[model samples]
Target: MPTPSKISVVTERGQVSIPAQLRKELSLEKGQQLLWEKTGEHEIRVTVLPERKPRGAMAMLGFAKRFRQTRRTEDWMAELREGEK
Candidate 1:
């Protein structure tokens, strides 16, 4: 695919604004996180980092509700090996 480029101006505090076209193409929203790296002397790479979210107490419950403790680890392994034979 052909890549599009746009000129950006860096602010006084070493900040650069991503253009609207690039933002729209990247589906960037307000308060999103970005990872930037200086790859070489004159080149930099940008990666989209996952958004940080605080998990509430309710969000932590019941994911593995069916989990149960086995009596022994060796028994579990034996059971798995039995199926292979």
Candidate 2:
């Protein structure tokens, strides 16, 4: 079965809303980016880019296995502070 076409109007600022049904089906979220490309004279392609994983603490999960720590937390902090003097 062919899916019915959806129509959207470009606003004065050139913004177009994606239909609710399609947004839900695609799992689109706010702040997500879309890639637009010109395919032909009258056609364009829009692709949903994969969401990027957050950096910092969340990105460091399970990273401890790669490097072993030999000193205690307090010892390490004290050593770092000693360098300031």
TM-score of each: 0.59, 0.61
| Cα deviation of 49, candidate 1, in Å | 1.1
User: Which portions of model 1 show Cα errors greater than 4 Å?
Assistant: 56-85
Candidate 2 residues lying further than 4 Å off, grouped into runs, are: 55-85
Estimate, for each residue in 1-85, the C-alpha lDDT of model 1 and write its tens digit. 6557888888999989998878888899998989999999988899988877557975668756668664698898999999999
Tens digits of per-residue lDDT for model 2, 1-85: 5456799899999999999988888899999999999999988889999999979999999888789878899999999999999
> How displaced is residue 14 in candidate 1, in Å?
1.6
Per-candidate alpha-carbon RMSD to the true structure: 12.7, 7.8
Give the winner by TM-score.
2
Overall lDDT per candidate, in order of appearance: 0.84, 0.91
